[model samples]
Target: MADIQIRKYRDDDAEAVKEVFTLGMSEHIPSSFMHLLKQPPTQMVFMCVFCALLASSKSILLPILAVTLLLAGARQLVSYMFNSYIDTSLKKDLNYITETYLEQKNSCFWVAESDGRVVGTVACLPSENLPECLELKRLSVRRSHRGTGLGKALSQTVADFTRDRGYAAVVLYTSVVQTDAQKLYEHMGYYKIREFVIPELAAKILNFTLIEYRLNVQGD
Candidate 1:
């Protein structure tokens, strides 16, 4: 988060927001463009040929040809998707949770930006079906930018947000693999309340175990 100016998201922030969402992960590349370029030589040549065909002068059915060639181009790039293991299966689960949480209109979303690049984000949701509790989700800082207190800043920001919204407690879940994050959560006053093999936690156990932590925001 690195002294970022935090604020609500704008429509122009789609790409930056996606970048912040993916930060601090070994499997993640800067962009899908980078992910495409890192492919093997054979795949690279295939992509080049397809792009050439896409720009050919003798093309009458260019649109159809483009779609056909693009599918082939996609096949060449499909391996990258397999190479990256999406921990937490967070993409799908995140979308689901965000949608549900937003429907209630009780969650807050914050984005951190530094030098025009988004480096971090924190999101809060009312916990489960509980009206008085909140769950912090998607708190992250870029790997190259850790130890700058963005995590704590996001936590405190979310805490204040929940308090302002009248929530009595704030809770969140983290992976056992993320020791630093667990420590940070604890340092920020979140306690390990329950441990279980829920879908998201179970997905992490395939790579590393996970624990759920809760913080009593009202107590503060």
Candidate 2:
């Protein structure tokens, strides 16, 4: 779409901003669940053992029922953890967008508008976890708007902000599942410097890791 405007978020854009972020994040749940299921310790081991029990035993009803319960439990556990993450994150940070991302001299939230609607979002602020660097957060683009250069535009916006302010670097974290995001970061000259295992059960079961990427900035 033409006229893709990247500007600071306004008061009226709160609802749209929340919607894009929520929906964008929710899109990963299905893939995450599927990944968890394939892990040998989660569903695969149980299923295999249940199958063996059924084949060898004459009275299989009770054993098969137990297997069914076990499988259901594993599935529910993943669901609960993912939903809890969404809830806690929204309450801890998303609800205070203005304060967390928009109020400080070094912090800003930006939305991408095309045809008078916000289809993408991004934010950056001084890193609390890292010194002398800015942290990029919540970079999301609606599905229909992907590959239209909005992602690059949003990223460059944060990099420009960091460079202008003479921050030593700009850093971000993305899940290992987000291949597209990794590609974009690398294309933009960001490189993976570290990786940390996610603390959630579902994430650990699936071997999910969070990759940290950084772009060193120089003053002009």
Off by over 4 Å in 1: 1-3, 25-104, 199-208
**TM-score per candidate:** 0.63, 0.87
Clashing pairs in 1: none
TM-score of 2: 0.87
**Each model's total of backbone clashes:** 0, 0
**Scored by CA lDDT, what does every candidate get?**
0.65, 0.85
Candidate 1 local lDDT, 13-123, one digit each (tens)? 555555556555443323333434444753556566666766775564664576567555554443234234343435544444445444557776677888877778778
lDDT of 2 by residue, 59-103 (tens): 689668878887677677766766777788678777788888877
**Candidate number achieving the greatest lDDT relative to the actual structure:** 2
lDDT of 2: 0.85
